[model samples]
Target: MKYIFFVLCWWLAGTLSAQQLKGRVLEAGKDGNVGLPGANVYWLGIPGGVATDVDGNFAIEKRPNGRLIISFVGYASDTLEIGEKDHYIEVVLKAGHQLDEAKVFKRGQTTIMNTKSPVIEQVITGEELCKAACCNLGESFTTNASVDVSYADAVTGAKQIQLLGLNGKYVQMMTENMPNFRGVSVLYGLNYVPGPWMSAISVSKGVGSVTNGYEAIAGQISVDYKKPQGSEKFYVNLYGSDEEMFEFNMNGSIHLNDKWSTALLVHGDWMEKEHSMHHNGFLDMPKKAQYNLMNRWAYKTDAWFVQFGGKFLDENRLGGQKGFREEMRHQIGEGNLYGISINTRRYEGFLKVGYLMPQYENTSMALLVNYTDHDQESYYGGYEYDARQRSLFMNYIYQSIFGNNPNQKFSAGASFNYDNYDEIFGDYKRTENGLVKNTPVNPQREERVGGVFFQYTGTFWTKLTLMAGLRYDYHNLAGGFVTPRFHIAYMPDEMTTLKFSGGKGRRYAAVLAENAYLLASGRSVNVAGQLLSGRPGALKNLDMEEAWNFGVLLNRKFLLFDRLLNINLDYYRTDFSHQVVADNETRPGMINFYNLDGDSYSNCYQVEIRYELIPRFDIMGAYRYNDARITYSAPEGLRRVRTPLQSRYKGLINLSYYTNMKKWQFDFTTQFNGPGRLPGGNQQFESFQLMNAQVTKFFRKWSIYAGCENIGDFTQKHPIIAADAPWSVDFDASRIWGPIHGRKFYVGLRFGFDRD
Candidate 1:
């Protein structure tokens, strides 16, 4: 009966309908009435609405009340009641004196939109970022159900994310629409971005448009930093946790004039001590320090806008046995007390320039250029690896409409990518005869690609939207390939949307470097199958992975008891034509790398709901199921296997509450992590639950927050295998499935001065 009732509610939500009206706003003048820009237009009681473009035009859906409101600075506000016969109307605003502002309250800080977008995209605002101790990008997704973040390895404390049961590397990472964080930086790049510096985050799932690239097999994540012109004058965040972590971040803006502005962001963090809470003889977490700095400048005019920025990062990490000291780090091959050390430095710069066409307000041309230099040196026990990466990227895009119809538009772009990697690495294993030797397999390669793409988008009466895109790319090693993508969105009513997407993606694999953590164990690396020859200098001898992704989603929003409710259901499937499988199931102490000989696929299904139960209280819940598998070649022919450490089922619940005046805020989140088959012995781990809570008190210019993570204190009894024999061949740390450490508490403070 409960399930039937839930289905009935969903059916009713889709049946609600509304009328959409389009219009323009102009300023009253003595000479003539001119279009007014930057006007706020919306329904009387709705939370979301469109803002006027440069031409001062708006389109909005209206309820039965048929009331519309328009307001702007230095202009008198106007309210219009539309009759059944009237559909489109134009209004002129007159200059008038304004009174004092009125106090306002909001139910939610995070908003998800599905009005016209063919692909599922959600924007996480800075206000939502404050729900937790979000010191870095990896920690920022604690409250989001779409993405799952977890520790990559038990020893290094490195974090990785998953989308639709796929690894984070399959998701393209971008900054302000420019490609960033690729190649050698994929393992640790998620920690380089400080949360306080971000203005918003855009997460898009499924096959995206070819305008971005051909690498997005799972999704795309784009980070937008606070703009120099519209950001606060000064901001500071200080954070500390009971786990011996401390962090500080500060940013300030400087305006050269009305047309030019710049902002400087600085960050520093450190974990001062090593804690072995589990008594496993290994440190629970790595002790590390990181320093980051960035400077961004923006120039805006009526005809053009340009932004340029540069960033620098330096980080060091150390971990291993509890007794290992820094002085013994040099004794890599002869150490009884194992230790891990890593040092990294990265420098990046980017420029974005856009020009608006004189006659058309919605047409523009944009060019983006980015460069990065990254270097790393690390040692795990007896293994030593060093690498450097140099990359340059350039892209050009042109956006325009078909004739004068805004609903029909297209974007064409060309891009160039270059990456050079130089690496020196060796793995060592202890023998029964009391000897340790380095293993063979080291690669230094370079890759270059050039591509062009065109995308066409069409919208019909705010009811349907379609996007088609195609791109052709030429790789130095993989030869040439073409990728095609398509997306369609249909709205049956004002509250419901149905979307579908399909596309192909390809990527060059860096097997050894990407799986470097496995080298820390006793596992011996082996390569099988026919290797591509004559390309040792360039994109190594591995088969490039190609896959096709298909997705379907349904989303709806409705009003219940004068509060808003949102529900979403989605399913995604990925089939690989060619893939590199890192097999660790055949043997206990062996890791094999080879191209797939059979089939590889993943299917994911998810359902999510968000409801505003009271005036300032919101509840969000989600459930997900994943089936990911691959075929491996074994001594006994071929067999299908479950991908190690991939969860099959998961559930989440998040609650948020705030006071009437927004002075006090509280949030709680609980997650259920289902079991997964482990590598080596194919062990099936038990399911577990995790809980988190936070409280915040806000002042005029400052706010303080305190939070606790893993509040239930649930932890894996033995995350590491053979903890007592770290030097033995039976030791393996790559089979971790759950948290290594227990409950942790943190507190932080944020202070800022608004430019207004």
Candidate 2:
């Protein structure tokens, strides 16, 4: 009782003495004052900070001895002392253009750390995207060791990403702070955004902010598109591969006066020829074509900011036996020749509005609205599936400093979501009486959710930060529920930082849509489980999945040989109170779906080390381990088992070198993939090693590069099951555990010019 009373008194005293400071950052150009968007601003010796908005405005809590620090790229950093009476100030930075010849530093390959973020966040800049063949968002993680990407199946050529040994679906994906790639998009949306359209990608592991809703179970990925006002006036990229794949992208920006600007982005890719490497009667990769376009507009002033955008995408793919053609797809039921075809179209529109109070520097409000429509039709062997979805999302958030001091910050928000889905599965078949019938495996749903959330952040002694958040949501199907989350960061010294987080997350399982990749095989689909009350249809009684995530992280940086070295270590665990299990091991020719009856969890640990080996040369190494298990109902009743195809361990090493003035560049990466268990047996796959290398030369306004992927020429012997019998019950294409294609060579060129 005494300890509790003392803690309360201390908190009360600290809350009564805090204050907030607001400011604007600009570049002192010779001709005029230029706002520096995305500038970093923070209080000296503090663990939390904020970035300047598009209009170059910022607000942060202040301390008794508060000192302000502001920094921007290509400019000299500035630090200023704050006075008690100073509530708002304007800072100007001078441009610095000094190049170090001996030690060339590249911004894109560097993993920037956000010291102010309560959760460990890593920022990957657009420059990093140039390091690989980054065709789309799914392929952008090739250089990032934290996220693992693999082929979902050999025939359809679908790629999937995993974080902390969990599927990417558990990771909330966002575009400019608004939700994206949920529901139907979860299937193939990873390929929607072209790499050239992105300015940066932010990755945060563990429980993320509750302001984005409770769908995040593993982590969060936020993508930032190139801004219309700051980027180059025009840019173009052209790429081609030895395997007949070609791509083109163009980006252009226009300024409609000082307060209004617009940007247009376009991308297209096509593989005109299909080729087979192993000659197993199946195409090595599917022939695909896609066209994507986006238009974004921005309007900003001293008090109000607005942004709106729209995107459209169309894609088609075909794959199967080497001789199979699109014309043969209609005869799939006859089974003379196997083929697969898919078509998809998507459209999206979003608007964001922000208001900054002129009288109060610490008060602001923001509203976000988004809408999406997606449709897809696909055929795999004798099976056919079609799905369509329409969704709308809106959120309004208000933020301000409360209490006696600025150290007490609060955020309140309300959100609404509506989704409608229509889907059909199965195929036309002939009955025993020789009558043709259209068999339907239907699963349809309509969901409406409204939620309100509040978050509080507190700082103590400038070295410790705490955040507590709660959200109340009403789902038409799941009913009412509350989610609570907490986070803490402590710095024992200037060199070491420790963080901990725990949170609850819930999401509805779109079982069929998410698992459609499984349809490429001959396995029969089964959906038998306890259903929710008062619900009817093919998907009746399916309960929502919920889980709790907890994690701990440690980061330290030291000086060695007059250079800086950084080490990062983290561990995360996930426990599922309820889960929708996709079971493919209990039966030989069937895929079963049911609710979890027992325990299901995952534990992961990772470590990373980075150091500068020499001037203009850097090396980085990382290792990770994952242990994931689940309980399933078998013929002998419920039993715990290891999740199939989950790697037990992984290792990575990267080396990079740059010549004087960064005119020449070289990069190499090697990775080790550990063994994993296969389905329906205790067998495990053999470990494999992969290597990649690239070289590039830069000119004044143009750059050209060449690279080779899978340099070791290593591939799985047989990626398909029962390859000779495509229509047999044993035929399955979803058991891929390694790369199916060997070495691949590609080249690309980029041209961009800066604007005055």
The all-Cα superposition gives candidate 1 an RMSD in Å to the true structure of 4.8
Lowest summed lDDT across 10 adjacent residues in model 1 is found at 530-539
For residues 1-756, could you state the per-residue lDDT of candidate 2 as single tens digits?
Answer: 884465446434333323557678898743358765567676655533555644566556655456777865455677898878888889998765433344222332256655555766788777667778788899888778789888888898877779888888888889988888887778677888899889888888877888888898888999999888766789999999898899999999998887899999999999979777877888878899999999999988878889999999999989989878878876643446788888999999999999998888688999999999999988888777788989999999999888557887889999998888898776544345431335566678899999999999888897898988999999999999998988898865444567889999899888877888888787777776522122235675467889999987777655455445667778899999999888877877778888899999999989888776776577889999999999988888897978888789999998888885678889888989999999887899999999988888888788999999999999888888887888766889888888899999999999986665
Q: TM-score per candidate, in order?
A: 0.90, 0.88
Best by TM-score: 1
| Each candidate: RMSD | 4.8, 6.9
Model 2: which ten-residue window has the lowest total lDDT?
100-109
The list of candidate 2 runs beyond 4 A from truth reads: 1-109, 333-335, 428-438, 529-537
Candidate 2's C-alpha lDDT? 0.80
